[model samples]
Target chain A: MPQIAQLAQTYASQIFWLLIFFGAVYFIVGRGMVPKVLATVEARENQIAADLAAAEAARAAADADEAAWRARENANRAAAQAIIAKAKAEAAAAREARLAAAQAKIDARLAEAEAAIAAARDSALAEIEDVAVEAAQDIVRRLAGAKVTKTAARAAVKEALAHV
Target chain B: MHQFTIEPVVPFQFAGYDLSFTNSAAWMLVTAVVLTIFVAGGLRRELVPGRWQMAVETFTGFIDNMLEANIGKEGRKYVPYVFSLFMFILLANLLGLLPLGVVGIHPFTFTSHFTVTGVLAAISFGIVLVVGFWKHGFHFFSLFVPHGTPAVMVPLIFLIELFSFMIRPFSLALRLFVAMMAGHVLLKVLSGFVINGANAGLGIGALVGLPSFALMIAISALEILVAGIQAYVFALLTSLYINDAEHLH
Candidate 1:
């Protein structure tokens, strides 16, 4: 019984100290820790926003540079194609002019062959007419028996007609 | 040589000053461990709570409902402190019934001691003092001086009121410790009768023993009731203190 009475005195004191510990924690929470945590969170969020904006600006600049490079590349390609076309046209014109010159030389050779053939026909016809007339006059004189000595017989006939 | 019968080991003391890690402290630590395990187990956050979770929920909800009914909207904010305070007292009281030889000086047992209970009272008083001042500021001082009193009676009223106010923690501590201590002593006294009768003779011993045992059982039951009642009184007073602080009354 005495033991029980004594025990009561002991336990009551322990409860007193626990409350002081809790009170201290409550004060620290209100005064400092909560505000610092909130400030850190706000600062982190703002930093992320700024980084994102800077990244977007850099991307836009890169896109514009790429577009300008592409336009110059396209112009270079078109100029190269035009130069090729012009070189091809010049080659075709040179081929045509060479062909025309070869054809004119061939036509000049054909005209020369025709002129030689016409001259040969005229010389042959004159030689054939002279042979035919000589033969005919020789046969006629052999049949008639009248000796006609060319200029001399003609001169004799003229003198006899004068005397008559 | 006579064989010695050594005294049993009490709670450890340092340089003749016992830290008084009494039965109440042991029980309080046990309650803390139990709460920790229970909370940790249910922390999985399942859609449907398990049996253990449900039990903890019942206790938390019971306190929640109490705060709601007693202090209304402003009461809910005080749930944590009230919860800790109630558990401490409840464990301390229930631990007395443990067969681990608490009534007989074992390492772990609920002891009816003013030191433990008084500490709890002082804590509550401290909280009341600090929170009241913080909430109500200098206006809280007005409670000591009642309104509409005659100038002649003011001095007398103020002294009485101050004494009564000072007694809040003292009375609260005394009330719980006294009831537990007295009840256990009564049980001890009743059990002694049966032992004394057996030494006299079998016939007288059996006659006295049976009834004495029955009386002991009854006292045991009453002790259990006292335990719960004292714990409730402690917790209720804590909440009332909180309420008084909140309202500046």
Candidate 2:
């Protein structure tokens, strides 16, 4: 009871100090500490957002690069296929030209061999005609005592070759 | 008995008022000093907070969340006032419970006096009044007259509402002051028993003294909890009152 009654006497000092202390605490915590804590929180939030954004950008860039590389690879393969097709065409053309040249040389050699055989056969036929003419003249002298001409013998042999 | 006594550390008078600095004032200074060191020392810009910084952050966040939950985002402007309110009262309560004379001085709680809580409550009530008028002008008076009341019941309801409104400061002050004062007094009484029992000699003394001492310790722990909760309740109500004034519903 006495304490309650004495509250009047004590109030002035208590309030005075309370105001002073409370004011001091308010400034220190309000001006000094609260902002720091808020700043830390804000900074963390901002950093997270930035990191996520960077990661997204990097991923996008990587995807683009991969797509470009794939495109280039496809293009190179197509180019290689075109070059192979062209090379095959050139090789076939070269092979065709060489084959044609070989066939022409074989045809020329066969014509020369046929001409030489024809000349030898003609010479043998001429010599056989002369011999036949002489033999015919000698046989007539012995059997019938009649002479045969070389022209007639040759003509006969030619007609016979034609018929055979 | 001397625990409740107010002795002036430096006796002075000004304008017929006892402006003398006393143990209560000294403890306030002590509380202020400790709070300054605790808060200001933790203001470093650490990416990962140290212990002191973490403690400071936790307290700020707790009050911030409480205000936001109770009063909405508009209550953020009152952070300094509410934060200081919680810290000062909480420290005063805890400091009062510290062992006396260990620091070669006796300390008293400012909150144990009705005057301290009275001032805080008055401030809270005053803010509500000023903000209510400032925001709504004459419309603030409508706070007492709820909508849809019949004409005959208006006066009666108005009187009741006005009475309740006026009781806010007194209720807030009494709740904190009485809790702190009574708990301290009860601890003092129990310790008195223990001392007396010890003085009376061995057999009956042990039987009375030990349990009394144990009970005192238990009560002190409970008082610590009460101390924290009371501070929280004070700030919470303050914010709620501010919200009511702001919204008028």
Candidate 3:
């Protein structure tokens, strides 16, 4: 194996330059590079913030749309409920009017029926009185074998009333 | 022909591995200790940061930026490891350049060996591999497989993907080793020439060696830049490997 001394003797000059190379990169990077990266990160963060703000605005808009839809839905429900109540009130009024008219018609029919019954009753009473007078004259003629005078008729009417 | 020579200093074998408590190791130890102290004590944290804190933070921030830019934010996770690696390499390379004529003592640049850098590269690759498996599970292995094609094309695509996936370790190891070794040898040979010329004659050596010295200086500057660049690239690629894991195939 080649000795470390021999190798070092031959290569001393080369070692020197390698050292120079390391120095330049070190100085430049420490001073220049890191700051640039930090700036970029800061810029990125700012952009993210802006994007989030815009997204929040969009979310708020969506919420507003939902609220509007709910409000319209509620209005429709209220309108429908009012219409149903109006319809129900109208139906009730119509039903009450129909019942009142039917009752009036029935009362008029009853009154007409009552008047007809009263006329019939008067005619029947006159017929019954004539029949009764004829019956009484026949019965008296058979019993007495002669016509009854007005005073004797009154005496028999009183005797019949006293026996009843 | 004159013989080339350098005197050996401290040498011993402590562990199973060949150990040389040479100048290189000394400098490496110094670098490690200094860094530990600097981080622990210098950055000993307060409510607000101080100058030392700022310096450490600056280094960390500098490396972090480079990784993010080159490999992207996915690269940031490797920052701690990369930072430590950079510190060690930077200190080693710079120390290697320092005037080490303090008495008879010399300084060593830890980056001289292909094995040293190769191991670092290999370790980095290993980390990438582990992460690939850790993050992606068996699917990372399937990075070798092609997707969204007919069953007829699957075999050919799989072969291609396999080759690409296999090349990562080789590429990583080569890039650092070659750059470091090549640059060092060039500097040394050129410096050797100047020393020879100066010994020959003062006037002629000044005339002849001036350009060599200038070349050495220019090359030195370039090497400094290259050293830092190589470390960054190593860390950057490591992060990319991590990213590959994250993304999978």
For TM-score, the strongest prediction is 2
Kindly give the number of clashing pairs for every candidate: 26, 0, 27
Error of 2 at B145 (Å): 3.9
Cα deviation of A41 in candidate 1 (Å)?
29
**Per model, how much of the real contact set is kept?**
0.07, 0.62, 0.00
Q: Name every residue pair that clashes in candidate 2.
A: none
Worst 10 residues of 2 chain A by lDDT: A153-162
Model 3 spans > 4 angstroms off: A1-164, B1-17, B46-48, B66-77, B146-153
10 residues in a row with least lDDT, candidate 1 chain B: B1-10
For each candidate, the alpha-carbon lDDT, in order, equals: 0.63, 0.85, 0.65
The alpha-carbon root-mean-square deviation between model 3 and the true structure, to one decimal in Å, is: 17.3
lDDT of 1: 0.63
Model 1: DockQ vs. true structure = 0.03
Question: After best superposition, candidate 3 residue A7: deviation in angstroms?
Answer: 6.9
Model 1 lDDT per residue over B86-200, tens place: 6556665676565565455442323355665677688789888898888888887667777788999988887898788789999988888788777766776777888898888
Error of 2 at B153 (Å): 4.6
Return whichever of 1 and 2 wins on DockQ.
Answer: 2
DockQ of each: 0.03, 0.41, 0.01
Clashes of 3: 27
